[model samples]
Target chain A: MRGLLFSAAICLATSPALSDPLPSWGSTENKSTIISFVESVTDPTSPDYVTPADRIAVFDNDGTLWGEQPVYFQLIYALDRLKTKAEADPSILTSDILRAAAEGDLETVAAGGVEGLLEILAVSHSGMSVDAFQDDVRAWLDEARHPTTDMRYDAMIYQPMLELLSYLRDEGFQTWIVSGGGVHFIRAFAESAYNIPPEQVIGSAGPTEYVDGQVMKLPGIDFVDDKEGKPVGIDSRIGKRPIIAGGNSDGDFAMLEYTTAGDGPRLGILVHHTDAEREFAYDREGHIGVLNRGLDEGPDRGWVIVDMARDWEQVWPE
Target chain B: MRGLLFSAAICLATSPALSDPLPSWGSTENKSTIISFVESVTDPTSPDYVTPADRIAVFDNDGTLWGEQPVYFQLIYALDRLKTKAEADPSILTSDILRAAAEGDLETVAAGGVEGLLEILAVSHSGMSVDAFQDDVRAWLDEARHPTTDMRYDAMIYQPMLELLSYLRDEGFQTWIVSGGGVHFIRAFAESAYNIPPEQVIGSAGPTEYVDGQVMKLPGIDFVDDKEGKPVGIDSRIGKRPIIAGGNSDGDFAMLEYTTAGDGPRLGILVHHTDAEREFAYDREGHIGVLNRGLDEGPDRGWVIVDMARDWEQVWPE
Candidate 1:
């Protein structure tokens, strides 16, 4: 009995937790094609075998990894923060946007313009150490609710991509989020939400200052990683060209370009938000999550366009 | 005969250059110790077995991986560029530092202050795409010589570290350079000198701008990855905490701290410049490559302090 116990312990220590295959929850002909191609490349016996060194994969954060409906969850969190601060000190009420946010009128505040949104984001995100800001993000995420779904912001993350991350890890691929969002904001919840650690999350950042032995990372009005900056961020951060790139909009076009340029069996995937009934769907004309250029070039670039309406069996977790 | 011909074709198609363990041209003890540690971690049956995902290793650029004697090679390159620009414009001669740089008196230029160095770096580095900057760096490095060594800066690199990089790669460790120097400067020669590709080189950067249809990465007056910024850079870029971190100066303290704080078996090494005969040895008070606080706390922190005077046989490539 002791020998058997010892053997079980040895096995447990030696073997890593075997991750499940890429979520086929959104099973479709397109998804199957991608899975098969990836499997072939990873198989050592196959002619298209890729070594682990060449197995880098990158994912877009917003529409690709999680839902960005009604409003960006971070923006909502910022608005709430602004409201609370205003309640504490009525001086914030002097601003038109802050007054709108205080009244819980998100549409009016949002319609006030990018300047107004920047004002809210700057005030809420500035003047804190990265550690402190992360703690705040964690606290807010734990307590805050989505204005529409009422689900936790983290819960709104797509189930398919979460499965995809696990599947990729199992296949010896390192996955990273190359997003235009705040790096720390996503990094705080990435581990809990998707099993990705803080180091693996790359995003836009403001200038960080080391003051009095504390490192304070402030949200810069200047976006560090966005649009064309996406490719630059990936280049600066990952240093390796990703073999697989997935996204839903033009923000990811440069990333797709950079990834597909690698000399290997590369995959570029674009998630098309086509299911209006199950989830929000607005493409081409939509201000947010625009997918026009990517949609048009999908066929020419050999990018797999995942039709959410047809592909996903379920969108979010129960 | 047909079967033999088919076999030959298959071999030709599948042949990736067979990688061999290179001889680490160091004393028997250092070579043996390095080899044994690498072998143990690589062996699947060993207790220290590290999977490819966890096998990230980082190297310091200046003195640890390469020779930075007399002066940093990048600074030399910047000074040279400054001289060339001054020769063309003559108006650049208005500044005392520019005049000093034009005269090839680096000490005089450096004495002018950090602001002087910033002025030289800004004009020499700004107004180019990262690709263009990399190309310029490559062009300069291909011909630039170490004033003291009278050898190409590429040839001035430590051979043991080159061997270590190749050896780690063989053992499934992804090698990266976390330097306080310019990213483009290191990237220009990393691929050819250390066999590390451009993407794996992370270094100090300036603000970049994307305007109209062109992307321009300007060398910022403010350095992005330096001192405490080392860990921030590593966290921001590589997204993986290094399992092994090596450095020569106090600048790498934060990187060592971050690397050692990781949840697995980790190694932190400090290269002490004790060999004044082969290489300049002036730590604590040295202007370049100073190993002050690192030397003091290295023993307490359990960091392996490699005394160049006693530990290394060769300082530079033969």
Candidate 2:
């Protein structure tokens, strides 16, 4: 009986069907759809097959690949930095929004909206070399933990999305991160957390000064890669239309539209934050990553809306 | 006797020494220096060995990779485009510079300086979709010839540089074109001319608007990727410092400085055009690709100044 059990276990281990590429994803329609899309584009015999060089897959960083609850992780880092700066020299916190951010008043800071947040970010994140800023981000990521989950911020990356990224890469798609977050902030952790290189990560950036052989982060927004700017960023950076685009917000609507509108087989995926128990669930009314346009029009556009609760077998990686 | 001759020919064909990677380059110190630099960084046993992901090599487009004699090929294209536009509607040539440009008055247009050239570019280049702009560039490259060389502009690329690009790529380096030319213009032929993909080509760009799923190139320069801006462009686009940088002019001085200043094995190559008999040779006092700063300080900074006439066995590809 023991020999027969061993034989059965060996048979199961070698079975191709059991070797799922996306183990973190449940055997749901969303998972099947994603697999089908990848297979269709990768299979040489398929009519919709795309060349490997043209197979670009882009993902939004904040809400799409990771949790964006209790405000953005970047904002938290900025607030923390602001506090430290205020502790060292109180004169840095000139505005009320800056004061609120420095004081760790989430309510007041959140109420200040994007303009106020940009002001804080420009102040807290600039005046240092790019390398220094990146080092600071790396240090913060290493030390900082989620307020509620207590996990390292980098560890909060979705296991299912990681699996998807790996799967797509395995299928010859060059995975990229197109985010509304700061390029430096995303680049600092993107490689370690998501296995995406800094060159492949595109995001909002500030004007930088090349001084004394160092690129200093200047105190001004160069371009905000959100909403319509996402597509523009995609055009300027990639110089080619992405075959696959994944996001979780209205900010990604234009990107999805632009990607899908391209004359070929393209995939637009919207990660619907449906699992409140596993991750924070907010969309239309959410302060960050609002998805009103996507939610209302995604289905008609043939976009795959992955229900996080129903589709993901696991949220965080083990 | 016939068999002996055949055997000798076979031996010569199979000899590793005969398999020179840079066939277009002469047996010069520049070639050996370039090879040694590549070897040190690529050899795993070497102390200066770099990982494949970090093996980035940036190059300037206009004079470094190809001939930019008389004027930039892009300006020639813009002038040709201006003529066509003027023939259709003369009212479009409102400014003296535009009129001079349309009438092919090189002297008058040249006297107007960079400001005049920019005004002409902004007017002639905008109001078209990026795709359309690229298509126009492609069409121009297909038909346009250098007035002096009488060869197609794309065909005028340096054969030695082509070999160098391929050899570096073979050695696991990601070769990128960081040009002062328009991104759209460079992207059109970069992939075909140099085997460099569009995403790997960084350049100056105008603002773009996303309309009806098409990215429209709007008027006004967003950034000039020359001089100090080269390093800034490298930071924003590539997000990592290059290990190797190649250029022909002072515009590339900052880029070369930034690349070599990074803590690693680095190589800075300046292509000095000294082959007036074969290719136009104008530097230090040339209207385009001025090289006073690079000529003055490049040797002290350990930069390889490749005398084009001496180093290159051939100019244009066969």
Candidate 3:
């Protein structure tokens, strides 16, 4: 039994499948520049060196780290939730978003705008305890498939960004996600997906209340953590100003501003989605993942605008 | 030069202060019981073992981790802020709390109850960005001394609790301070004083808003994070339900209840302030730090009620 167990263990340890390395995304000048700057800051002998305490890096979620092609993944979750709820409660069909969602016309529902989105979200998100909501998110992620990609939303995460997160961690940098998405929803998957722990994820939050005689937290959509609230959420949650920040839109402009304004070897990179072949390519005029003012002003502010067409060889995990 | 450097390094490495073993605080029966329970749950070989990912411990700040006599430390900070603000604008003297504050009568102002406290906290905590508030907290902590003890507020922390935090961390437990005090105020000292990071500190928070192009997160007097809010804040911020909880008042009873109700080997401890000679001995009917319901029902619920007078040889750091 011992000899058989030893052989099995040796096979497991040396197996090609178990030891398979992460796919290589050919390096670019942009990647090298980012790596070099981080190296200088992390190296103790360097003049611009920073300690582990000072090594804070923030990344935007939607288009920057993951594919946000067929609308935001959160919106899709909200839509599916709307459909399910509508089936249980026929009265929900009277709601405009629900009606559109029941018909599977996501485009029409989205076109109904922010109010429509908020209505869908408020109904789907509220009335559940925080733990219940987390479990719901975990369950949904486990089974929910993206509409366009037909893959698990988590698997659609950009492989290159995952590599960056790992590389930064190896260099003692604490990585964080500063998103406009719901804090708890992202927190549920961030740890297992990116290796960034829940404590490090700062995002949109709602007011929460405890039910009497229960150990549950319920979230109410009172505060949307986007635009100016992005910087605020980061300040309130992380306390430390980020030394490195990555984002893809004008919504993330404030975070980029706050991070780059800090003294020291700071870095601000904007992932410009300009690959129409593999991904969408629209900067100033794109309705989804809009990058208007940020694209116009990034070069002047010394922020590197990552051209997706030229920079990344692949966008999603194989 | 190399030979001399090597000799100096060797001498420093072999220095008595670096090499000599320190004396142990003879682990009493109480300490052993607590350590043994924690070890059994945390040790993988033990049947009751818990994973490191699930090892969560929560602590109360004020009277449990530190001394909060004569006045709550944050209240003292508020009074000082009131005096400073009043000095600049004598018009603030028209306010009841400010008037009492100006006359050096804090008890009179506080007697107005929660409303009075809120007024004082509003003027003291608001109208500043989160970063500015943190800086002010740091500055105040540096200069401020406790009224009765004449010691720095940070120094008033119980040395045993500080050791407990380190011990818990060494045993793979993530320790958090879930207090009724302002989160940022506790966060300012927690990292340096107890090694608990800012993200791990959850407290009563006032509604925060974005004003004048900056994010202002302030404490509101209305949102007392006591009673029901304790569990609410814990669930919202920590995400994971704590396995171990330490507290001292009726305000913390809800937290203890929330923690102990979890499955498996959980521990809940209540610190009874029974050391009038060394500290202060007042509970149940006491106006401050009341421990009425918890004291009576703790044992029935399997919570360990720590008798401070009898259980501890030392209170605060000398």
Candidate 4:
């Protein structure tokens, strides 16, 4: 009888209803707000109830889901790949920007600006089959580590964000990743890292050609899924406005605005990275993931600005 | 006792396992092949068993799903819209092609060729918000009927194909529509007509802009999801090659080839429209959806050419 009672207690404690849905989220107003929003939309009796089919939650990939300090992870992968290619064929690094990128000269590459960055990306990412490029990305992810943290890129994914994703999915919301990063680059690890499927990911893409039977990535910019492009990407890809939009920078401001501006119940979340001890912290003046406009007007728009240092009990998974 | 037995009998007759999954499909080789392929992939004991996540099935929309006879339904819609716009402002129809389209002169428009057709499509389809365009399409679909059949375009959807879709879905395969038609146009009716969602429907798209807060359609082709473009679009959008591909035209040749060429068990289906009594029968030499390459190579590639007149017991929903 005692054994039975003990077992029952254990079951009760571990049960889905009793257990914390977002264990990494600290006991804060933001946590409660997120839970309340999800519950209100999921409860059939609630006026804010949304159908499972209509319960879409979109998230930005870089910085929002994982760390993107120093540089975007995709750029790191591209530079590393470019270096290997240049070693095999030195003529491939014709331009100074290409040579700088291949040599891991971040300062010189940064000075080259957007055009040079695009050129480097096009040269590094294209000329290979889509299958081959994805394979290379997978291989790099398996071997590569972050410059500062010495941790695998996938391992840097936010534990709190993962919990939020699971909780939303538990409440019948479909989670999608809308990123300014390369679509192919994000797709390579999104499923395993964040539980987001390839089809559910929308991002900047380059032109691809179907040569014989294989689809080959081509040299050139096709579309940029950033800033104003975020809204356009969401509309074209998902064909439905998300009920919830989560991001960490101004790149996602349009996405969050578009989502919240829709009729009925909506929520916009901006993860303010302020945990200098656990994770890198920079926002207003940062070169990457600058949050000037978002920081200024987010609170006024009824958007929840989450302080990572205060709201998260844990940064990364155990 | 008699009533109870009768109730039991009715239950057995109506049971999913006992009832025919594809009742509209005749007891043909094509039907058997489809069933066998689905069962093989779904059965855990089978060597060809595929996980649910990888069980993707792609389908072409237009003539493959419904009728594209007199012309593509979208062109018909475009002409009708052009006529209305011309009525409001006669100056809008400045070009010869535009005037011909507005006056329902399809012969003259056809003579104007692809360039003229694109011009007509751009003028009629663009310069409106995505939401407004979809709403306009919905309104048009509600009132419009086929000039010859006098049946609603949505009603002309194949019954056998509908059953096939439901069956594949039951077997845990995700169904997607890869069409050459306008993405916005197909999205308007796809959900209601085929039980396929807007996001699952990939098609040719025009440029869109994010103005103020709305995603407005702009004049110009963004990407054409036809011929070789089909494979490119599938790769960019879905990010996975489908296990099963169904199409009725040369435009889908690349897509079908790409799917079948992928490693492991795969199936390609070509719907041969031989049901002149119920639908259009033109194929190899038809102006739209020409199947010169498909008809010649399909059999050699182990593709199941579905003879609509013989394989289907019913053409359209009653």
Listed for every candidate in order, the interface RMSD values in angstroms are 4.7, 0.5, 3.0, 0.8
Question: What is the per-residue lDDT of model 4 for residues A37-113, given as tens digits with 9 covering 90 to 100?
Answer: 99899889999999998999999989999999889999999899889989999998889999999999999999999
The candidate that achieves the highest TM-score relative to the unseen native structure: 4
Q: Which ten contiguous residues of candidate 2 chain A have the minimum total lDDT?
A: A9-18
**DockQ, structure candidate 1:** 0.22
Q: Residue B77: error of model 4 in Å?
A: 0.5
User: What is the CAPRI rating of model 3's predicted complex?
Assistant: acceptable
Looking at model 4, the pairs that clash are: none
What's the DockQ of model 4? 0.71
Of the candidates numbered 1 and 3, which has the greater TM-score value? 3
Q: Is model 2 an incorrect, acceptable, medium or high docking prediction?
A: medium
Candidate 2 yields a Cα-based lDDT of: 0.90
Q: What is the lDDT of residue A148 in candidate 1?
A: 72
The TM-scores, one per candidate, come to: 0.76, 0.94, 0.88, 0.96
Would you list the rank order by lDDT, best first? 4, 2, 3, 1
User: Which of the two, 1 or 2, has more TM-score?
Assistant: 2
- Docking quality tier of candidate 1? incorrect
Task: In candidate 1, list every pair of residues with a backbone clash.
Answer: A199-B239, A239-B199, B206-B220
TM-score result, candidate 4? 0.96
Q: What lDDT would candidate 1 get against the real structure?
A: 0.77
